[model samples]
Target: MTTSTHEKRPNILLITVDQMRYDCLSLLGHPVIETPNLDELARTGVRFDHAYSATPTCVPARAAIFTGQKQTSHGRVGYQDRVPWNYDKTLPGELAKSGYHTQCVGKMHVYPARSLLGFHNVILHDGYLHHNRNKHSVPMQEHFNEVDDYLPWLRAQVPGADLLDLGLDCNASTVARPWALPEHLHPTNWTVSQSIDFLRRRDPSKPFFLWMSFVRPHSPLDPPQAYFDLYKDADFPDPVIGDWAMKEDPQGSGLNPVTSKGLVPKRRLRNAMAAYYALITHIDHQIGRFLQVLEEYGERNNTIIMFTSDHGELMGDHHLFRKTLPYEGSTHIPFIVNDPGDCLGLDKGNVVSEIIELRDIMPSLLEAASTEIPDTVEGNSIWDLARTNGKALERPWREYLHGEHAQGMDSTQWITDGWEKYIWYSQTGEEQFFNLAEDPGELHNLMDSPQAQERIHYWRSVLIQELEGREEGYVQDGRLVVGRKPVNILAHLRSNE
Candidate 1:
């Protein structure tokens, strides 16, 4: 461990993307999507092929990330607000207490918008939240104002720039087009600019923790023309559809978030995906810019850089557009940890395939700073796995990750061990199992296969144990429960948000 002296303390840079998928990076063998910077970032450290966002949405996923605890403990079992984030030991809060100056540069999906959750300063940019701007939305309380930091800056930089010039609905629609404004005025760029500025203004006397959250590859599919052009004619892979997923096939209409969901035309799907890939590439370039800044400060070798996302986007997979599902495309997120080689005395280029979650971020970062991990935290530090390349550490490392999302959108629960996955739809009492190793697209349901019945029962029992005491009635009489009320933010906000 480093001494308490200021010079010995290293900086921690935690970067999170909004809705990027785990397989988007080129290093991960994505066919056409180019994420060169992120690929380079991965080469510098360890990347988890199986990292997941337990809640797989903006609000609840971030709750687990900042708290290092399960969604149940955080009281954000689904997409919820106004439940009151009463946790005492948060990621940044703990880092702050450890004498490290903490700053969040973008996207705190927390209630009240400016709750800080415990950052010293936050340059907020919660990209186009339906609840925040829609006056007709169920308003539970006064919030931190609907005006985000990026809009004001964009307007100031380009006098005639309009946020909605392309006629895209930031909340619902999945329209794809080149950005009307210059690339420099984009929110992704703005986030990095503000993060770089924080590095310049931070106190040099203490180790600093900066959370750079990018909101892109999510919606408002507007990339710069160059980026859009790069993928406009690219041979992108078709959406992988499972035989059992024919119910959600792209034969429906109206592209929106929750209500008018299920499949769009093939042309529209390709357009949305092309724009999405462009956004990922653009964000990767901006991250490259931020890393350049770190190198300039000669702090690159003294800082631990971690990259991840709140959750993955479905991107037309299983005919789904947004988050809140048990599918791999929705819950899987890319995670990379690049510790300065000499600084942390850690190995490099290790790829860990164990199942991990958003909750692991806090305890891992806390461990990096020599801060004690709180008993309230449930996530295992990735450091243990990184040190041994997934062979070391103690007992009770989760064999599988339990994932769920609370929204009327497929109120689902799933358990995956990175090889096989089992899902339970609470409302329909439906069960789906997939041998992920053989069917990464989740094309074939193996639940009814006589050969996989034993594995199905094993995972079902695991999920039952996971939800035993939950009020959602997910479990009862020592058996799996069904037909419970699905998780929904709209429903929760109608009462308290």
Candidate 2:
């Protein structure tokens, strides 16, 4: 171990990938999709098999990651349309105050891409995609433009490339063409390049906290020609419920509701899956490059590297395309933490099966970095589990993991207690309960089962208690709002003007 003049504090490198499922990595033993770098990281670090996103969307899940609180507590529930700007303290802000140099690259999904929140330096690469907007000045929009720009180049590289027409909106007539290019030209590669540059130039005296968030394997399923070609002959597996062909969950379906469509055709599904997997592999390559730089800078051993996703992609799983559902395919994500033993004494290469939420990341980082965790933060640190090689010091440390999704009238609440998961929908008084241990695929609904009646009742009671505790009162016209804070002065001014 390298000795330091002062007590050595671990540097923090938190990597959040967009729309990544838990089983993508080779380490997770997936038959398809090669993620060698992530697999290696898992071997050197601790992987949490049961880790899940508190809010299975972009903004709220990100907010939960930055602040050790649930989405309801922080109030950032959905995309750009209805995200709450005013929220509680953030982890980066806390770390900055504690003498850590903070930086963020790639996507944060905050309203304004450059909203620092707490980082000293930020390179905003992607943000929310505004459906109604025309201008493409924002990072996310610009990134989409970049994809458009690269299409011509991709088409020229391939002999009969007609895949460029398969753009954003779902079109049954469209088909993807094979790509032939290097992974380094991908947007994720560029994001990793920016992060590596920042890491190389960052001052070593103060511990650094960098957020490398990559927007890949998300949508538009666009990978370079070479990556697409790599999976040309591979047999793409059908969705778990392919035989059923039943679209039970309306919101989770791959088809766009406004357009009134169904699942993409079999050929299109194969091409999309291939492109998606290629994007993931490309992302893994970028991650490997970033990790190499960290090692070269002698920061690997003294750094706490966390690899996770804001949420997961359905990726045609259960015939679902995007997130914002209460399913294993939508909510479950890979959470790997490489806490080098020199500083944190964390057991290397252990896979923890504890049911932890993304909100716990902030507190866990604080604990690992020897910094103070805020009292207002709702998540508890899993430092003990890490240090003790996945062994729980206390039984039943957490009874259940909670999640909320409130976008317009499409609101949902779910609680998972390892063995079972319960979901309650607000729009329609629909409830779904599943015994995950027995039925991993969640094909059977246990809410009406006589044997599961008591279990469902107990979980429903817990959900009610949690939601009641988080109820926010609103005012009509000029009446006083009981639980709502007054709108910020700047926001009020902007609105009035």
Per-model CA lDDT versus the true structure: 0.81, 0.70
> Across residues 1-497, which tens digit of lDDT does each residue of candidate 2 receive?
22362237778889998888887888866777899988888898888888899778777788788788876566655444323345447889888887788998888766544468888987765522553133544445334334232334445665454332434432221234433345554567768888888987886678889999887777656677777777766876666653333565455333442121246566767887787788788788888888888889877777888899888876666565567777787788998888664566667877777788988999998887777888878887876777674455865468788876654444567899667899876655678898989977777888668999999888877776666633332223332223243221223223433
Looking at candidate 1, what is the lDDT of residue 127? 77
Q: What is the lDDT of residue 438 in candidate 2?
A: 93
lDDT of 1 by residue, 207-276 (tens): 8999998888777888988899999989989878788764643534535433225767668778888999
Error of 2 at 161 (Å): 18
Q: Between which residue pairs do clashes occur in model 1? A: 81-497, 82-497, 242-443, 406-487, 407-487
Alpha-carbon deviation at 408 in model 2, angstroms: 5.0
- Estimate the TM-score of every prediction: 0.93, 0.82
Candidate 2 TM-score, C-alpha based? 0.82
Q: Which candidate tops lDDT?
A: 1
- lDDT for predicted candidate 1 compared with the true structure: 0.81
Which sections of candidate 1 miss by over 4 Å?
Answer: 1-4, 136-147, 159-162, 247-251, 254-261, 487-497
